[model samples]
Target: MEITPIPAPQIDLLLYHIQHHPAVLDDKTKHLITTMFQKMQDITNHGDDERRELWIPADRGTIEDFGDFEEYLTEGEVSSRDEFEELWLSEYPDSIKWYKLTTTIYENTCYVFLDNKLIFEVRPVLQNNDTKDHSELAEWLLSAVDNCLTALEKGEYNAFVADNLPYSKRIGKILREDFWRIFPEEKAAYLKDITPDEMNRFFNLIQTQPPDSPAKRLPEMTHRLFLDSCRLGYAANHYAGTNTLSSMELYRSHADGRDDGLLDINEDSPEDFAAWYHDERMRSGHPWEVCRGGNSTHISLYARCDNRGWWFTLAGSSYSRSVETVKFYLALNDHGIPAFLCDGQELAAMLAGKDYIGIVPGEVIPSYCGHLFPDENIIDFMHLPYDHTGAIIEAVTWHPLDRVTFS
Candidate 1:
């Protein structure tokens, strides 16, 4: 529980993304967002404009009395700052409202009300004393960079990003860096808080998953893991590139088993027909040959992309709708990730309330391999969806890849 003290500029960017980004937000969150901006305006303008209509939400929690009874008590009178203090303070001295305007010049802190219910309060700290001014603060709150999201791009966002980050500049940084690209090195830790639930989810994935380090980890990274028909699925849909690139290499390894062990008896025309058939498969998005060995199966569940590292996690389903949890994990297995940390569907199964989190998996990982990741790992995450929710890492000590296999 340490305070990182994000800069005012950074904090403002975080706020703006959450408020304006078109990501799928929960009903309560969506309601809070609308009222947040409206509250900001009201606070800055001294609450002069009596709201003609209360923003009665259609979906979120309802308010039985949105000050309907209080309006008559005040005779529909607009309260000035002096009156707000005189009347409200006399009635509710212990209320946080008493300190709203007095705490900061422009009321840096204030309660955000929705349907007359206090949703949350904005009590942000200004990093620089110079940022205490109204105009600068307003600019910070309102700044919107064009095509910045495009500029922020590096790799596409996945289910983890979407579910974890709603509107986050930090996610942009993590995506750009591809920090988790390095094998078992750094994680996108700074982006979000690590919850106990997430830690359990990580362990669940790891405890059942197989290990990779070919020479170091036991049972050794085997060729048979891929030599079996799965290499077909692996090569057919694999990540040809590392975590840092936009366009991934689509490749069927030279040793891919696509053309391997062709039956001489099955082909009437023999040699020429076999060559033509293999070529056609390659051209038609199918593997041209069967692969036996030497292809890399290091499927990346996540990675630490760059040196700058992640400070905050970005949110929003918009971030990685295309790549659901299961799909990403399966893609790794398809591409030859022999031992993986976890897959989306299994990860989704651990989600608290929902059977799956983020985007649901469309196609199940084929049965040549079990859908559940069978590889063991040094560590993994357990994600919690309900009751003090979020993802946390569960670390089980296993030797590094440099260690030789004994068993």
Candidate 2:
């Protein structure tokens, strides 16, 4: 492998790289590397009242031993910086830390953590060293921005924003202009070390794949996928909504068969009535009317939901607690989603009367759908309890219309 020279802003890069890949640094090197990084990134107080607690661990290896590298380690936290360093040097006092930092002014590019400790600053060979134009730094940053946008167009969404863009747009301006009020001399060297191209490339790979993108081979896989994505239990009840938003179709059940009246619930009354029926059957404190007098009803209310894109299903002994199943129909319209809910008992009855109630009539249902498992970040925002860790396919997307057609 080819090794590159270090760029300017030396100590900062050394720490960043080491912290990310700690396995490469031995016990002693880890301490020095972490400390150096922390120092450069540390925030200070007025007139030298610089007291702050660093989150450095006392030892290495095991998960418990992993040191605190968070920027905001409190003064009361265990294993202060000095104490950690003592443990580090005790293990490898002879190990000398080394690294260098420099930039290629001609290429308008820079590198850091070079030839092991001497922090050398580099800048474009100036036409007149006597006069300085900070505008060059802004131009370099713009180049990084353009490169990042281009990478995304080329299907590289995980691009990075180095000092060039991370602090580019407005933030860069504030730092270069106002920040210098406190430390005026900081710019010349710091501005020269931004690795525009590398940073852009690194950022492009961080793209997240949406949850429902994967191929699901099972019949009602979409529901399972939603629950898993949200990490919540699939409330075993059929929830209903329209098909307006983008959503994914799991299994489409329709009221297309003969009504033997063996298992049929009221459909003409108000939504609240259906919700109440379901709540009563499930014996839940939260009364609802959807999945009332359960079994497998073709036109019954399986769930209750308000206008705010939330669905509720029955969870009780009527369906057997041991088996996780729900009777549900999804509200469609927000996304191209299909309604597929599974209540242990309801699903059993539905399957039994498959010929009567429209069950996967060997055709794809005419429903608009998108993935229920939203992009990773959106899922992260979902409250806990809803963010459980099971197969997540029960979550549903909302839509504007309330009807589904089966093949």
Native-to-model Cα distance after best TM-score fit, residue 102 in candidate 2, in Å: 20
Q: RMSD of candidate 1 to the true fold?
A: 22.4
Q: Which ten residues in a row have the lowest lDDT in candidate 2?
A: 166-175
Give the alpha carbon lDDT tens digit for every residue of 95-131 in model 1.
Answer: 1110011111235444433222233334443223322
Each candidate structure's TM-score, on Cα atoms with residue i matched to residue i, is 0.19, 0.16
The parts of candidate 1 lying over 4 Å away from their true place are 1-108, 115-207, 210-327, 334-407
TM-score (C-alpha) between model 1 and the true structure: 0.19
Give the Cα RMSD of candidate 2: 26.4
**Can you tell me which runs of candidate 2 are displaced by over 4 Å?**
1-25, 45-266, 271-407
What's the distance in Å from true for residue 87, model 1? 41
